[model samples]
Target: MKTYLQAFDLWEIVNVGIEPPMLRPNPTLAQMRQHNEECAKKTQGDVLPTKQCFRHDLYKNHGL
Candidate 1:
């Protein structure tokens, strides 16, 4: 058995009804792609795919 206690429940704090600033409202395809690319670049400092990094391994396993 486990027991846990929280300092405050969800109702204890206030939350705004409007969307947070980080969220986008119906972005265009280009806008969405740019946002995704930014996030990917942020994660690794540079964005790269495993396929581009390990071509020999791909050819050995799948001949692709």
Candidate 2:
């Protein structure tokens, strides 16, 4: 078994670890801003504000 393992090529093992390039580039800052605006419009006034939602007393009582 040791001899068989030694016979395998090290370069082939290293080459297999390489990752492929991304097919699409990342979204720009403008795209991120547009997405945030859309989400805010959808959720506005329907969801609790972060400050209220994350209050320690609210979590302690509500177990959320």
Candidate 3:
């Protein structure tokens, strides 16, 4: 059996096997807008939000 490295770096950032400390699915559109507004306030301006950008065709074609 192969042993994995214990150190964390970019490669271990998004491993699915580990539990995320602050991961949650975005809520409905109204809640999303509220969250977006709050995030914009932190940035001190409007930010073009792309949290849920999707390219269904690409994933479908590429077998992602």
Q: In terms of TM-score, which candidate is stronger, 1 or 2?
A: 1
lDDT, candidate 3, 1-64, per-residue tens: 0012212221223444554233258668887666555534543321223212345555777887
Per-candidate TM-scores read 0.34, 0.33, 0.30
Model 1 alpha-carbon drift over 4 Å, by segment: 1-21, 46-64
Candidate 2 colliding pairs: none
Top-lDDT structure, candidate number: 2
Clashing pairs in 3: none
Clashes of each: 0, 0, 0
Q: Quick one: ranking by TM-score, best first?
A: 1, 2, 3
lDDT of 1 by residue, 1-64 (tens): 0011111212112332443225378888998777655544433422244335577787789988
lDDT of 2 by residue, 1-64 (tens): 3223223322223446644222346878887667556545544443345446558678899986
Best to worst by lDDT, what's the order? 2, 1, 3
Per-candidate Cα RMSD to the true structure, in Å, reads 14.1, 19.0, 13.6
